[model samples]
Target chain A: MTHPAEIKALVFDVFGTIVDWRSGVARGAAAFLDRYAPALDPYAFADAWRAEYSPSMEEIRSGRRRYVRLDVLHRENLVRTLDRYGIVDVPDADIDALNLAWHRLDPWPDAVAALHRLKRRFIIAPLSNGNIRLMVDVAKRAGLPWDAILGAEVVRAYKPSPQVYSDTVEILSVAPAELCLVAAHNGDLAAARRLGLSTAFVLRPTEHGPGQTTDLQADDAWDFDVKDLNELADRLGCPD
Target chain B: MTHPAEIKALVFDVFGTIVDWRSGVARGAAAFLDRYAPALDPYAFADAWRAEYSPSMEEIRSGRRRYVRLDVLHRENLVRTLDRYGIVDVPDADIDALNLAWHRLDPWPDAVAALHRLKRRFIIAPLSNGNIRLMVDVAKRAGLPWDAILGAEVVRAYKPSPQVYSDTVEILSVAPAELCLVAAHNGDLAAARRLGLSTAFVLRPTEHGPGQTTDLQADDAWDFDVKDLNELADRLGCPD
Candidate 1:
């Protein structure tokens, strides 16, 4: 087992790891749909909208488009998804409000308390694909006690790009070995591990819904494998 | 007086505005000198070291050097100052620690409490020249409750360059008029004002020491002028 003594900071993958984005988005979409397109299935609407997340980022990653902040991309994706559902003529204000639903995600039950505990001993922050504004709004809404805001916007490059991890390490002024990347997804952890950063996996069995087959548990021999954030904090020796 | 209702975020100038860098550096220098060079005048050393700050940043601003983080600039400036004072041969670790004294700056007496009050109503952060690591360290040490970190490294540009202020506004996803730049220095507020951001001036008479002649009071027709952060918070309608 790797010792947690030297880790000075823990950067998190925000969407599913810290907040229940799936449930939050579904709830918000349902409310919006209930008011407008009452016949639409809100859960399917949310899942389809989320399905576009990576492809939207891939456009910038492949240099097919200039880098746009996540908020703009979210708005664009929302419009396209609404079009696919035969829902049109949505007011700009309503569309903007629905797009900001990403910022108001509710943290998992254990997230806030565990993060407060972790924060007492380590610098805690989100290294998400979300831009600074989205992350800031999430932090405020969800009561995440972040020591700093870091993400693709700061480096102007998305994750899985070596630049994102390298820039985070540089900006934090810590060696890769002295920082830990905590995520529910194996891919995020794998990338951090490849870059020589320590990795911790916290299982989120239903992250992609009950049928999720992948990342139901740690897939790689990460530095730490914990059931939840509280356990991760305990493993890191943060006081209860 | 400008209404505070529209302002959603408050971005600060860190060094002289929030933290008393001059006194903090002097205290840290005195401690270092007591062990290594007891005869040295620590205040003069601290002042001489700070005197290099603007010029060091000017190198990057003028494109004479690539953009480097503030910690790196502080280290280089420390080395040159030590050499000028005929003090050399310090251990690399000691020099590094001494350079990081900038990260241990003490917030002004009213800073923490006032910031807590203001944070309830507005998103408060340091839009500083200091990089993320330095800002995070200072926040941890000084108990400044910053909502997010925004600064030079995040934008890859220094203050007074229109890019820094503009990038910050874009990242916060707020209109220039909807964000406020609060600083002790007129130059910072002036730059922000030129870019259409609201500005607040808080007096920090001893920021450059008791003999300070500049920035003793608001020098422009700033949107708000007050004696301290507490007064600024009061004026902003943040509950006491």
Candidate 2:
């Protein structure tokens, strides 16, 4: 079958696709600011934190620093971002609590329902740059029912690398063609396709919130594309 | 509290505790012999195959060879054992099929029911020497309802290693004391307890069938000792 009849597993990109991480962080920070840091601009703070994501990963990739998890990376970025905004005097405990904002990121409205549908047909897991500890914590805190949590920590390599995709297939013991990578980002699907994985694009136009300029729609002729995860599950014939 | 409080996760040792491998292999071999080679002593064949288990693990542990997964080791052992018994007429495909006996292991009668009970209260996973692919396949084939499968493949290290215990605890993001290792063998419990993990022993005295010489009963005081997994769950207040 030219359609790759053996695709038995689906690995998801968590931040934008499965969960509305940007908006979730904005909301979480808004709540935190309302409760404690009343003077902080929660939305601006959320954007600043999201913008630091890549630079922090680059620091690790470039050997400017050793490996650190998203939780630790978020804390470091949070402290620096707060300092940049002239908000010193944040308590260490509060900073620690704020770092967990990522853990509490809310799934998109259709995420849980869609995953529930997909779980009936395939092994679904998070294939992300998040560390295992971070992802597992997020799963527990957010009620994401992943069959397994596959992450950078498992292979100690970041995404867009062929090793990451190959390592996932090796660890899962499934052939490259027997798994599909589902993400909102074209770059992730491009990388996975290079390593022989099938691809599905689920649009998350507001991943960066209003005026999000990238990944607003499918950028390539991916194996499958849908408006959201629920639609993607349906397109794949995952029974409800 | 002397009794463990608020156990949030339960990690299991797979081999003898969950599945009756010895009896399954013996029965399969007896049936295979009855169908193909009436002259063979099927019980002796089963014991010979089982004898390879410890030496295979020892070989890898003592650095006589690289880390070969139990699946590969079983296949190699089966080839040698079948040769010794002069059962060479079996096709290579059949030999490959027979090597998968590990995957076809039958669960102990109480395993599913007790794990179902425990799952209602705790996140359940298998902390096994088996590789991730092996464990996942076994869980699927044997109808094991593990919330996740954590194996040596995750850390590339075998159990009783502090790395394995710490990797699991770190991934689950729980304190060592909040996680308990439940196993049929005493040594497994001793390792967990030494690493500050709560330990529960489920006696599987017949794991090796008649000639079972070790772990016949709880050899040391642990956090909990019960007759079987069901009893252990009851002791832990896992509701029916």
Candidate 3:
């Protein structure tokens, strides 16, 4: 965890780390539900939709299903979440557009500038569970300056699975310790650290919206623990 | 062959299409030769080094060898090419750096600006034989505004192979016709076209220097045949 100077690239976790998915999804869902289930809580809808993310990926991670893109998984989860709310009769096109809510997420206020600062020194990319198309859409919409997109789809495995961590490092052709995984989730950091990668934790108090109890702080020691990406950039000696 | 409005992503073929590898490699070889074989023609040296590219890839394309990165192939070819030149006793570090000459190739003058204009209208990425790291290095140094990098290593297959075309289109999550391949080489276009991807032939007349004969003219009818990336951008109706 101490080889700071040796870190050549910093790969990020996207969902709650780079972009505020819950807020964006809620906003998108607000507009979406206004035309459908006006009484449904958009935030609850966002939470409900997100609630299905892990268990759906668990099927693929557990080898019960073959690898598929995140978009496919998201669409599947959206249907299931809709049924949970008893919402029906949504047009296919509307459902498709709503699924892309993930693509339009707004970055943390400090994320973009700090990412540009970090990009000036290190190779920066998303090491998210999102697929390449999803990463590209989010980067284009949010102006995230990524050198490349690397994630679960590239290696056909999701995070915390050993393959996701190892295959991503291998794809980069760098020493495991030389690629840092910057995430808001301690479990993600722990998995990456377990795989010989360096780790940095960015504290996001309301990643799941307050009273969110998880990943609000660094749960364990990390190479760099900071309040935001700006602090992470500053800690790594990137220019302001 | 005429789905102009449908093209959502413009994936490029990098070597002769985006960058002037012959000139850049010859230039790099010239600087390297100043320390060693000043008697050898840098252009000849460049061509000789490039001579191994197809055969090396053919090994993988034919399924006779396991998939390896272009960097690895380049390093192996470097030693062979050096022996062909009867040059030896070079330090491994220097050889390693020289092998990375692929990383430092200069983009054609019109490429970066044209790519920027194209990026505004579509997702732009490299669909090259070069590996991801090589694409990233070239883009960073040359200021190529790629939305992502997609190529041989990403699909673990070389160009003109079915997977190289189908898989890249699949990776972009675009319909084959919705992804346009802008390349200088006709055979590359031919292969892409065969797979139902749209193709544009950007003529790079002097890719092999003044005596360049091949690919100076479009070999077959393509979706768009133009003078350079600038013209290709114009043909695609991208803004100035």
Instruction: Give the top-scoring candidate (TM-score).
Output: 1
Candidate 2 per-residue lDDT over residues B54-133, each given as its tens digit: 77767766667777667777888898888887777888888877776676778899998898898777878889988766
Report the C-alpha displacement of residue A113, candidate 1, in angstroms: 0.6
lDDT of each: 0.90, 0.80, 0.91
Q: What local lDDT score does residue A201 receive in model 3, on the 0 to 100 scale?
A: 95
lDDT of 2 by residue, A63-131 (tens): 678776667778888888877877778789888887877877888889888887887678788988887
Looking at model 3, residue A80 earns an lDDT score of 94
Candidate 2's DockQ is 0.49
Q: Provide the lowest-lDDT 10-residue window in model 1 chain B.
A: B1-10
TM-score of chain A taken by itself, candidate 1: 0.97
- Model 3, span A1-240: residue lDDT tens: 565688999999999999999999999899889988999889999999999999999999999999998899999999999988888888899999999898889998888999999998998999999999989999999899999998887788898898888887877889999999999999999999999999999988888998898887788889889999998888888888
Using DockQ as the measure, what is the rank order of every candidate, best first? 1, 3, 2
Candidate closer to the true structure by DockQ (higher is better), 2 or 3: 3
Q: After superposition, which runs of candidate 3 have C-alpha atoms over 4 Å from their true positions?
A: none
Computed on C-alphas against the true complex, the DockQ of each candidate is 0.84, 0.49, 0.75
Q: What is the interface RMSD of candidate 3, in Å?
A: 1.0
Poorest 10 consecutive residues of model 3 chain B by lDDT?
B27-36
iRMSD in angstroms, per model: 0.7, 2.3, 1.0
Error of 1 at A203 (Å): 1.0
lDDT of 2 at B89: 81
